[model samples]
Target chain A: MPSFDLDSYLQTQVERVEQLLRSRSDEMGVQVPPRLLESMRYSLLAGGKRLRPVLCLAFAEAVLKQSNVPRMVEDCACALEFIHTYSLVHDDLPSMDNDDMRRGRPTNHKVYGEAMAILAGDSLLTDAFALVAGGPEPVRGVLCRELAVASGSSGMVGGQVLDIAEDRPAHIDYLTRMHRLKTGALIRAACRMGVLAAGGDADALARADVYGDSVGLAFQIADDVLDVTGDASSMGKPVGADAAAGRFTFPAVLGLEESKQLAARKVAEAIDAVKTLEPHDGPLAALARYSVERRS
Target chain B: MPSFDLDSYLQTQVERVEQLLRSRSDEMGVQVPPRLLESMRYSLLAGGKRLRPVLCLAFAEAVLKQSNVPRMVEDCACALEFIHTYSLVHDDLPSMDNDDMRRGRPTNHKVYGEAMAILAGDSLLTDAFALVAGGPEPVRGVLCRELAVASGSSGMVGGQVLDIAEDRPAHIDYLTRMHRLKTGALIRAACRMGVLAAGGDADALARADVYGDSVGLAFQIADDVLDVTGDASSMGKPVGADAAAGRFTFPAVLGLEESKQLAARKVAEAIDAVKTLEPHDGPLAALARYSVERRS
Candidate 1:
């Protein structure tokens, strides 16, 4: 098969995600209070790379070898985006990261007040389960369990706890574990959910796990590198805020060159991990490469 | 049949719930940062009425006429408490109600700092779904869907948004709707889930809904009354907090006497709603009356 067009595939998937998210936001407006819905919609619709959901959809395609993404797969992808967005909203709260801006716009708490921001985050998190539970019956339990485990205490939230507790760099092992739970967990879940959606077997699930873990770590390291080198105009947030906040980042723990080399190695591992799903795995391979190569 | 001892039943059920919660908290401690788990346990195990879980267990018994609570039923009860605790933690955030004390102890944020407190809340909410998803396969989807809808944007969170929006008393209809979604949704879910867990039919579920809705409203109205008349020591927190916050409470919207009368009528209706369950529903019936009678 011809080499995959990574840009084209991502653009198509992103548009699909935006449309689903927009319709869901409109539905929420009718059901919830205007300002509350506005706060939720404000952050959710604010455009980002839609990277997690894209990976979910791409993985489903690779595993199923199907041209059309199933409705359940799309819904699961949307759920991933919602979970990611909610985490960002809560992470940007005044008490958390205290981030004033995100995705080139005022953060959720900045746009709506702190109370509404917190509620908006709660709503998004709850609604994500509602979305996944709407998937096909056979996989609903698995999907819900995966997403919850990936996003819950021992996963994303646990990582954030460690991140906040980091007064000083303790050890490289600690930082690696923190990033794996904080960012890697959900990224890993996105791929795993895709495999589940496509009814992939245990072997396929294991392969997806390997692919996700490598890419998730590579993605975070790349983010650290970008914090050191990327422009704010494209990244849509301050570049050096992590350093200013005394964050223990990849580049901080490892020198810039070393971090870059590590990210490159992880990306290569991610590509290799998905080889079993080849020729349909081109997009997944491209995403792994993009994890390190993207400025944002 | 002999009359059910409501106090004894509640005492036993509450103990069981406490044991489950303690074990779960211990599990979280092992998996997460100590401080994060500490923040969660501080609020979750701080001890309140445990009314929601009791109501859930009672309804399950009413529907199934069982002598002992099943493991799934117990798990569902724990999930309810977890969700309730998370809401309280987030509600106590400085940006939210900003209360310093809860259950006569310092609030989670006060003890853990704002960031850890927020994460603790997120963890609880996420963990609740994880718990429910672990339920029996046949009803796992339904349990997850029901809990998600009742606690999500259009339910409890929506009520909160409305609560914060109310600068003064809105129309009675609006206030009623807000309270129903806010406190009423989860109470209703607690009962509804009980029936679902027992594999009850539509009729059983309808009865649970009616019982939950009436008692939930009565419970909130009674809470409004206690805010005016109860002592802080007995209430485990300051009295008159609602009024001090300028919250549009039931007692504030309606005069004190009117609120008291409404709560009495709601309690009566709640008791009457579960009449179909006959002798088996004695605890549920007594619990409805207790909703308005309790000082805290």
Candidate 2:
């Protein structure tokens, strides 16, 4: 297997995702309300790990047997980012988590007011489908279906509903199910979309699906751990928010040590799942491990 | 032109739409949170004119030269209604219009609480695309793109932003543009999607586009006029909401008499635009006239 530098790979792809998002927002500037566009840009352009888009592009590259990302791959990546960003924006609304800060800056609603924030989130979600629909016709329907299913009622939004209804501590089974729908669905969809965009065979998609599911669960566990262990300044938001909100979390259900152990086990399983892709999947393997180990 | 029973036609199709919507909601009930599903069902199954879905099916019937509505056409129609209903739910949030009632009952947020209402709206909007993505492959991409563009920032959401920003009475041009994006875009898309679903040729689609545009503008003008002239009991919501909200409106910009006159002229133009469809389009013509003439 060829040596892979995960940091460099992420940095390069994150830049591409950022540039595409910025340009797309600019393209929409003239057509949308100035404040609405500004609110969208504020949240979309705000810095994050860009993990979903990177996972999308990386999977596409692996499936296509190419070193360079294809144009359609970038479009799919941007769509994933848009959906993820919109979810975050809506999650931070006063009616939801009511967070004032994200990425160490004021949330979209805090800056643009509640109405514009809601509209901005709505725009981002709608534009995501529009972006995917603009891709090659052969895969447009597939991509659209993947995105819509992952982000819609039975997926992200349903998870949100479950989360908000959590007035008491939840069982491990309930927490797992909630996280699978809320966070795992989008992550898994991002992986599947990359393979679909590349027209990869069913076997390749199956492998990617397993890899995504394992990694998604591991990622949430790691997030839960970080919320307990990390500092507010480093996390770019208040630490222990889950505890403060009295929300169900991995660490809450399984103690911190057990949560860490479970996350490690899931990451190992994710890496093993992707081993079939071998030489071309170095970045993916690295990503799975990074999910559980990342400080932020 | 063959005599058309607009009332009976609307009655039967609306029944079909209501049944489909109910079944789909039930199908989703198992997967979604109970409260969230209730909120979505509350708004989606609520009684309304069902005009958008009806327009969609009518155009498809005309284009296909068939008396029966195809399943995909009905699917597209339902998707249009879903988008429209979601917008109304979100728009009624305290952060937005703060409306307490809609369709002669409490609004979603008023009944289900703010967080669940927001999730319900988000789920509905996302599911609209999911529903379209399930349509026939040949038209799925086209339908998805049209719906997304019509409902996205550059369309409905953009119009909403413009609407919310109106602290003072807006000029005619600004108000026109706002209504075009807010209300007109989805109406126009409903007509276009109907043609697209039927695999109508370019000429048919072009003619439908013009018909939709004229009717859409007329519909909004009529709505503005009704806000001033109609009763709350019949309209299903309080009248003069625009005035109470201090928002820019067609009547505010054009005055009641001029707005009424413009709506009549547009309805005439809309009827003229669909004349090429002739005998099969009688229902459509009546719908155009009704846009300006309906009591609610």
Candidate 3:
């Protein structure tokens, strides 16, 4: 089998997700105040890897085994991106990471003021549900449940609290748990939601779940590794910001070499989990490898 | 035929909503970090009128014409309260209204610090979707859409931005538009969601919409009037606080007497709109009057 062109796949998928994110909010008939909408669009349109939505689209295509996926998948993909973007906006706030820079640009709060930034994050998060809930019936509710549970208190938000707790332990188990919830949950939801949106069967869903879990963990470990080893310019943010903030990270608790090994192992597991759909190197497999390979 | 006991109805419904909110998060299987849960409960269970949830329940009962409402209505009612509580938490943030007190207690940020307060608010908002999505099918998606639309960017958050806009006009139209999106949108959602959950048809929904709009505006105008004339102890926050903050209030723009008169007219209109539900002074009618007549 021919090797998949991972760069071309990512670029195509990213552009698709970007277009939907840019226009879907207007299509939904929801009214946002002008300045508030500006604040939301500023952060939302500020570029990223678009990883979650790309994963969602990839999963949908893989499950359908076709080029054209359903509109439901498209909506869920956009919703996943919105959720991911809102987290970034809130995480960069003055009360959270107090980040001044993100994605090679000024952070949302830095550019829009803390209040507008907070509201922007709030709007993005709320509108995500609007997007998912607007999808086709039955699966729409399931998607909402998946997105909410993954991103809500027990999922991403819970992980955030753990990350910020002063008394939190710096052990590997604690770090893994925090990362699993903080970043892992939403990524898993993104993959699973795509399958659900595509009307995939239970077996397909279970496989997607496993692939999501492995890739999600690998992505975070790679993030931690990048924070330690990558250059600031390539990474778009300071290389050691996490360590400087005393954040509990994989490299901090498990050493740099061990973290790299764990990420590689997770990538292998992710690739293996998706082997049924694509025996040879496929987009999913390449994405798993790229999760660790990417500099930022 | 007789005067509805507004106080008793409020007490019974508020207690039911309070109980549901206190326990529903656990029932939803959404895991909240302990401290984060406490921070959310600190403001959520701090005890306001529980007006939004109560309105939801009342509408559900009115539409069903029975004592027992569906569990879906209960879930949505709790979801409405969750959204309202979250808005209050965010609104009181240091970067926003900077209110040190709410409902006679130190505000969320004052108790949990700014970061936890923000997370608590985020959790509440996200978990509200969780609750709605966990409800019975078809209607579950509809309920999620309604809740999200009413509370998202164009709804409540949009209104907050308008309220805080530096160049916002002090006219009554601006105040009305701002409140309609902010407090009005969610309150309207509470009423419409109850009807939707109960399987009420278009006419029922339209009536609820009218009732919601009229009552929502009246409530805000009365609130503005209270800010001018009510005592701090009774109100649970300082009287004249809104005016002191240079907020554009109905009373400030229309004068106290005119504001009171406008609220009365709105209350009358709300009661009239809901007459089909209970021809005489029903719970809905009494609640409309209470919008303007209440001391706090």
lDDT of 1 at B252: 77
Q: Estimate each model's TM-score.
A: 0.97, 0.97, 0.98
Candidate 3 ranges beyond 4 A from true positions: A28-30, B28-30
Q: How large is the interface RMSD of each prediction? A: 1.0, 1.0, 1.4
Model 2 Cα lDDT, one tens digit per residue, A1-296: 66688889888888988898888778756788787888888999998999999899878988887857666777888889899999999999988889999999999998989888899999999999988987777789878989999999999998888788856346888888888889999999999998988878999899899999999999999999999999887799889888987778888889999999999999988888888775745899999989988889
Minimal lDDT window, size 10, model 3 chain A: A25-34
* Per-residue lDDT of candidate 1, residues A124-152 (tens digit): 99999988887778889889999999999
Query: Which pairs clash inside model 3?
Result: A31-B154
Query: So what's the TM-score on candidate 3?
Result: 0.98
Model 3: per-residue lDDT, tens digit, B1-296?
A: 56788888888888888899888866643466789988888887899898888888888888889869999999999999889999999999999999998988899999899999999999999999998998889899989999999998989999999999999887888899999999999989999998999988898899899999999999999999898889988898889888777888998899999999999999888888899986588889998899889999
DockQ of 2: 0.82
Model 2 misplaced stretches (Cα beyond 4 Å): A1-3, A167-169, B1-3, B167-169
Per-residue lDDT of candidate 2, residues B1-296 (tens digit) = 56777778778888987987887668756788787888899999998988898899889988987868767887888889999999999999999989999999999998998888888899999998888898777789889999999999899999998888845345888888888999999999999999998889999899889989989999999988989999988999889887887667788888899998999999888898888885745888989988888899
DockQ computed for model 1 against the true two-chain complex using alpha carbons: 0.81
DockQ-based ranking: 2, 1, 3
Residue-level lDDT tens digits of model 3 in A1-296: 68889989888989898898888866653467878888888888888899998989988898888869998999998888888889999999988888899899999888889999999999999999998998878789988999999999999999999999999987888888898899999999988998999999998899899999999999999999989899988888888888887878898899999999999999999999889976489889999999999978
TM-scores of chain A across the candidates, in order, are 0.96, 0.96, 0.97
Considering only chain B, report the TM-score of model 2: 0.96
Ten contiguous residues minimizing lDDT sum, candidate 1 chain B = B164-173
